[model samples]
Target: MPVQATSVRAPFDMPGILVPDFRHSRRFQITEFGARPGDKQSTSIAIARAIRAANAAGSGSVIVPAGIWLSGKIHLESNVNLHLARGAILRFSDDPQDYLPPVQTSWEGIECFNYSPLIYAFDCENVAITGPGRIEPVLDRWKIWSARPKLHMDALVALYDMAYRNVPVADRQMAIGQNNLRPHLIQFNRCRNVLVEDISIRGSPFWTLHPLLCRDVTIRRVSIQAHGHNNDGVDPEMSQNVLIEDCVFDQGDDAVSVKSGRDMDAWRLATPCRNVVVRNCRVLNGHQLMAVGSELSGGIENIWVDDCHFVGDGRGGDDHAVPINNLLYVKTNERRGGYVRNVHMSRVTATTLAGSVLAVETDVLYQWRTLLPTYVRRLTAIERLRVSDVHVQQAQSVAVIKGERDLPIQDVRLSRVRVERVSGTPTIVENARDVTLPAAVGRNGASALGADFKNSRRI
Candidate 1:
């Protein structure tokens, strides 16, 4: 059985040094791992053991000295600081099984087996990993697929006897079925007062940093380069009071994505991802610069994106290196019956090679997804969303914003959005109507298609 976590919000759900919340205190040091820079022991084992020990002692810091420490699948605890000093590297081993015994985690809201990430922290409070060093993987590009694969129980059982002599079979069994996270580089689930600053993360196996159900978290001055699959920079799921600023992402997937739970796990953990502010960041060569949904089952509210840049190298062409509906994409698939509210975006600039802007797509047919289509019982809504001062040049297509046929893109407003491309004219509102546009931006210089409106007005 999965470990049941109670849903009672602590007196303060948002925890961190900057906010008020309840959490533990723990400290540790990782010097015992016999690995050095080029020849070091598995830092994963050493760090995991350190977190376990820090919880045993009082709350404090888990110090990583300056050197190359090799490791994999490091789990974090509440009330501890995983600190790496200058000139330190927490390198991961490429052995697939070394990241075994999966834990419950998500990707695009689908629970599946993948390796536990290098630095994993779940359901924590007042936790931090602050340092000025690189947390990287020893593997080269294109070797990531072999390094992480889904968890197989039969394989776990076969390797269980010798590899896991001390760990109980029940924990192992539970782990095998849980959402395998290559353990998110750092996951703070339902945590508060989380701070990750002044760290450099490159050459990661998957998504670099993930914070789920957390509050009052801050990520600053972090340089990330995970040029591989599912390598999003930071995924803040159902969180609140988050600030991700002064960061750079050159990744293979979306740079930053906001999410809710997926399926039953998502509905059960019905937390709202709200009050997030990301500014002064550069998004280079990713699927989406900043995305929300496909997995927004829980809810998304009160999000703000400002002063971010998405630059493309003209490779995607009409295919689009940065593709989406609205520079801010809001989509709901088969399992989407959640509410998206109060999203305000401003001063966002993009140099898209292709794709649309103000995209509001819905898969009401719901035929393509893995899960059964949820009945559209309640009203499907994306209310009170606004975009302003967006300028895109040289896009293959114009912007299009549309909602599902039954629920259409309702209560969305756009102002001063300019799309300019060489060959293809940027279209707006493919099957969308009742959406508002500024008086100056009323379908200027493009041929619109598939736009069916009931009653719409220009601001």
Candidate 2:
């Protein structure tokens, strides 16, 4: 019973992208289902009942009034909108058992059966979680899971082996072994016509908002402040025709990370993440404004980011300044066999950055280098990256490109990029072709790119 709401065309350059509109949906209040404030079990049961009722009614909104409601895992049904009223605070419990009966989910790009995300929607259509309120976690227990001990690494290796062996997804389960794999805060898996709007998310155990294998998704006017490990604000993986706009992110990882999937599993699916638009967002703290991969074995293309900027002194949870590392970072390795192309970024501004404006590395394996031997060696092809009108007050460098010798990165273009002060080299290039930048070096011996430079050369 998916909602037959108006499917408004997305306001982006991508074709065939539609956003769900649930303006006239009926309301099913949780209070009417015997939900009480501060009672986790009651609220959880009541929410389930309300969702069931709403789904049975064809299309409806399960509303939470202005109160602090403690809940467990809240699963959404098709056509059901989980709406939180203005003063509502929907707080989730951190007890891992609450997310029991492991659902089909992925951890860090590989598919496995893990603890359910705090809010999960699977194979549903026209689902949403809208709020002018707040959603946070009772993160006492989850905090302990954040530190990746040896057990966690062992579990990841196990999952990698499973994927490498092409094991059936249903047989690859990680929830049974006290694996301590942190569950995502919210995930929409294999769903379509998704909309998440006007929500303020405070903390997350893992990635905050994830759209996996979804279509026609719109995330608008969302604010996130999650400072835990791997707390990437939004991860669009294997998704198409996505729009992320009017958002604010202060996170421990990248603000907006576009991923496809990991190695063998992704190659099997053969789905690429494409046609994504990120605009009019502000980053307070993050590793990168947008990171294309480290897990992109399924390929990524047609990404456009514009009118986004870094703001607010880039502070972290300890009240100390946490410098944003880079504006655009694309990372892959010899083990990843995919293609990255047609990425365009423009009209971005920042006060200070800890790393370069553009960074592309082909040898970033992170902890996986020693965790396990390379099961397979396949090179990734990265090309056609364009950056323009980026003005940063101070940064370490302008560009850093490290590509493989045989298949180097190709067609990198930067124009109207102004850096007030640079602490290091203007550009460092190796194994790349067709890199175009401004001709004039800065007064401080640093390089600032502008429109006047048009020559392209291999490095």
- TM-score, one value per model: 0.77, 0.95
**Which candidate has the top score in lDDT?**
2
lDDT of 2 by residue, 79-176 (tens): 88999899999999998899989999999899999999999999988889998989989888888888878998999999999999999999998997
lDDT values of the candidates? 0.62, 0.88
Query: Least lDDT summed over 10 consecutive residues: which range in candidate 1?
Result: 1-10
The root-mean-square deviation over C-alpha atoms between each candidate and the true structure, in angstroms, is 7.8, 2.9
Could you tell me which 10 consecutive residues in candidate 2 have the lowest summed lDDT?
450-459
For 1-459, candidate 1 gives per-residue lDDT tens digits of 011121222112422225322233443567663334554344555677777777666466678888877776677787667888899888777665666766555544544334565666667766777889888876553243424343432332333231224333233332344223334566665677788888898766666788877777888889887765567788888888788888887766778888875534456567778777777888766766677876787888777777787765634322323342236767676456677877767787777545655666666333224222343344346777777787776554444565655665556777777665424544455444446664332234443423334333222
lDDT accuracy of residue 225 in candidate 1: 75
**Residue-level error in angstroms, candidate 1, position 200:** 1.6
Residue 296 lDDT in model 2?
Answer: 94
Q: After superposition, how far is residue 104 of candidate 1 from its true place, in Å?
A: 3.2
What TM-score would candidate 1 get against the native? 0.77
